[model samples]
Target: MFLKRIVLSLFCFHVVLGKTPEIREDVRKFPDGFLFGVASASYQVEGAWDEDGKSESIWDHDTHKIPSPIDDMSTGDIADDSYHLYKRDVEMVREMGVDFYRISLSWTRIMPTSFPDKINQAGVDYYNNLINELLKHNIKPMITLFHWDMPQKLQEMGGWTNPNIVDWYGDYVRTAYELFGDRVKYWITINEPTQICLYGYGLNLLAPRLNIPGVADYLCSKNLLLAHARAYHIYDEEFRASQGGNISITLSAQWYEPESELYATASREYLQFDSGVYAHPIFSKEGDWPSIVKEKVARKSAEQGFARSRLPDFTPEEIEYVRGTSDFFGLNHYSSYFVNMDEDTINSYAVPSRADDIGVNVFKLNEWVLSEFSSTDYVPWGFYKLLNYFREEYDNPPIFITENGFGTYYTGLDDDERVTYYRGYIGAVLDAIDDGTNIIGYTAWCLMDNFEWTKGYTVRYGIYHVDFESPNRTRTPRKSAFVYKEIVRTRSLDIGFEPDTSVMTIDEGH
Candidate 1:
């Protein structure tokens, strides 16, 4: 035990020192059944958008519309061409020797018109093929029902802000459960409700972009939570016993540290807005929204001279329905920020959005080293701290890290930064697990680079680099892919081992 602490201390020091240090792989290995997997979203990876009778997703409509919002003005119309090339994807997963593969279902693909009557047989067959392929390769499937690819029909009816979306989502998810629930054992109802509510609605960033700012986001939040809860109960009531599956919602959280002790409250408020608002209603024992979120949004709405509140309130029965819905906290964490009080900006009303509700200015930590890829800082310790925050604040629920990885704008095979980042973060996960955080799994953000939403293909977060320029969308395994494959294969963080991506070989487990 003393030696373990010494090894852990050395690993932390190596992270802080920004230098390679000698370490024992077996000592640093994750616990048994600690799922080392990779994730991919439907719209991002699956092309053949119009093929197989699939209708237009909001992403399909948004990226094609005039004044495109994507960074490269690129669309996921062709994406990684995984729709036609899924066999290759399965081969890659098999090569990785991972325990599971996290994949999302496209709502438009399943029910193109967003109605119960029109079940796209081709779309259903495609997913069946994909799931069966994964299962054939001995890779467990972790399926996400919605990864922000709302059917354009649903978006036309006011998207998430429409109260009817609760039923709409319920019907769509129920259809999914009935069709695919037999094989899929791990289910994610929604992926990052905060992103859907805040980025897509509050800010005009994502698809079905509505720049309604403060008002649209709150309405969407309430509806989104209800949608997730309703789906969970549907699974619990109709599918759980027979399907034997676990259901949860994925929430993206970037750890925030106070810029100074003075801004500690601001940091806490950042948490309230970013994660607490979405998670509190479902995960917290007391249900309802976070007290800080409800109080602040109400106060801000009143200040803006709104009747009632911009943030909607949940009825008592609704709160009860939403609580205790998750079997695990599906977390998608990537980076960290240092937050400080910015009252002057908060008072100015130059821009009235979700940012104003928290009344804080956020920046990256001082010590973080930036890469050429994205503005994300490499602070693995932040992950450890974030896990502890959940452990203490949210009653230590079982956790599955659905997405955590490094992103770079460059598409290079030699991603030493990503390798180091993974090592440090995986080490941090082990540290958090040792400290009593109920974390069960850790999935790398991606299996290969795909169309990264608004950023399009500007940033690459995958261990395998996809040649978007190539007609075939050839996926070449990067050094990081080899490293990850080794980790998953060995179930240990073998820091000293160097992987050779030049050759292909499955682990002994395969």
Candidate 2:
């Protein structure tokens, strides 16, 4: 035991001194029964925005009405034409040799009226065909019910901020379960509620740019959580026994590292605000908002002259309904931030803003390596810490890394940086597994390049490159795709493995 402690101390010292840890071949091997898959969202990939009785989503409305809302002045009106090319997408998924494919169902596409009053048969046919194609190739399907593409009709009706959205969303989710739950074993109720509530509602950075900060964003959080719980309960009570499927919500969980030990509490508070707001109600033993979040937001609201806290409170019944709603923890992680406690940070943010309410400043370290085309920095240690944090804080719930990938500019077929990013982050996963994290599966962020929300096509997170300018929107596998394929095929991470990028083809029996 003394010798083991000495070796562990040396390993920690090397890690702190920026020395690379020795990679053992055994460390690279994934546990048997661990799953690998790739992911894509509806608005990001599917075109045919207005075709086949499909109504407009908030993304369609925002991109059409707001000038230069996207970085490339581009709209997802015809992203990748996946509506027409889903078979090719299934082919790509097969080529990657994954266990499943994660895709989202567009709310407006299935229910053009944004309600169960009418179901669009044509939209149902589209997904039916995709799911059938995937199953034909022996690939399981994991479907996300919502991925930040609320129907324009719903937005006009106050969207997620209105308490009535719970029933509306419950009706939509019930219709979806009745339609596709039989084929889909994994169902994600909503993807990245933090991104939906904070970016879209608070910062005006995403669709339906409400920009009401601490007010509208908080309302969206409560209503969205209730809606998610509604969907989970509807499935649990109505569909689970018949379908034998699992349902959960996805949260964007970037690590919040403190700049110094002094600001550790600040960093924890930031994470509580960022992810805990959405995750706590579902995963926490208490089944309510984090105590720190409630206290801080309420105290700030009082000082801001508000009669009540900006953060909404959950009723006792609502709390009970939300607790244990998720079958698994769906996480989408990318990068990390160093947070510091600074009183002056409040002045930089808009008054009563989420940032000001949290009362911390976050920034990336200059020494960290950034992705080629985006602000994401390489910090696999953060990923390792985050998984362990989830295990410790949330009672080690089964975790599926529903989205993890690096974005880059169109740098042709050789994407070495992305390859490195995957290797490092996935290595972190293996480390977490060794330390007893109940991680079940891993998923790449996307299958191919498509419309990347505000970034548009400027940032590509796909293993396969899509030529957005081409009439066919042709997709060609990048070097990272081959590397990822090898990892999937072998169920091990070969840090020194190099693929022959001359030609890409599906492996035998894939």
Candidate 3:
């Protein structure tokens, strides 16, 4: 145990030290039956938008129209060229010993105008070929229905804020069921509604960048959840009879803590708004918005001179539609921190008056309550707490560690820090599983590094590194890939298997 700690420290230090860990690989200790997988999204990797009878999505317009918004001014123009090289992608997934491949369907790709007045055969062929290819290799295809890239037309139609979107989304879900539901057994309704509503509508950081007054984000939040529930309802009542698949939502969360013992009172309210408002309605036993959120939104709406509460009201029918819409919870976790609870103290920030739910003044383990923009606190144990919280709260609904990985500040094939990040984070997941959390699978954040939203390609999150300088978008496996590959292959971390520090291997691709 002491040796592992030293190795972990040395791994982090190696990023700057330019030296390597001397540990042996056989010493790894991951357990058996731990499933492994890699993930990618439609907009991030598929580049032939205009070629396949597919219409543009909001991301296409956002990334291309304002290239300057991205740090490297890089767009997903050719991004890994996965739309064409997906067979190679399947090869990589098979080689990695990963049991599942998680990918999202592009709304614009299938239903050109975001509506199914016409089903694009070419668009259907794209996913159809990809899905069958995965099955050929005995790899399970895990499909995410929507991953933030809403149809461009939908954006003009008020996107998620417009209540009509609930029906529009249901149509899309039903179409997907008709097309690929036969082979694909797992489905995710939405990636992260909080990110879409809070960042896109509140911070103006994502698609359909509309920082509308009270009506933008809150309405978007309500409609997004309703859309998810509506889609699930259609699948359950209309499609499940023949399809027989699992549907769930992938939620993003940052574990919150109070900055100080004295500040605990204040931080809880912040979390209740940011995390609770978004999650409680779906996960709570009674399936209604938390009392704090209902009261707060009502008071804020009244102060803003609105006749009705800005937050959309759920009809009894809508609540039931939104309630229990998940077969499992898809959790995308990365980091956490304690937060400053004092509202007045937090109000001093130059944050937009519209954004409170963002949980400003977060106290990372580094002892700084920085904003989420800069908080990369490393707390693996937080995931254990998270899994336990859900296990107890939601009556042990199954969980998939949908997305968990560390963001990097440096680059190299020898990603010791990433290995450490995976080791600790996944170790925490294993711990939760031991304590009886119904976590059945784990999928890392991404397969190859690709366009990262506003941050662009500057942040690297892939186990397999992609060279942006190369026109070919060449992918090279980082040392961490070997670490992860072994975990996938053996379904155990051979704390015993050391980094292949032997200078070089004569046998290539063995």
Maximum-lDDT candidate:
2
lDDT by residue for model 2 over 320-416, one digit each (tens)? 9888899999999999888876667657899788898888899887667654454457888888888877886788999999999988775478888
lDDT of 1 by residue, 198-253 (tens): 88998888877898888898999999999999999999999999999999999999
Better of 1 and 3 by TM-score: 1
Compared to the true structure, candidate 2 yields what TM-score? 0.94
| Candidate 3 lDDT over residue span 383-408, tens digit each | 66666666765789888878887666
The models' CA-based lDDT, in order, is: 0.85, 0.88, 0.74
Choose the strongest candidate by TM-score.
Answer: 2
Which sections of candidate 2 miss by over 4 Å?
1-27, 370-375, 508-510
State the lDDT at 390 in candidate 1. Answer: 86
Candidate 2, clashing residue pairs?
none
**What's model 1's overall lDDT?**
0.85
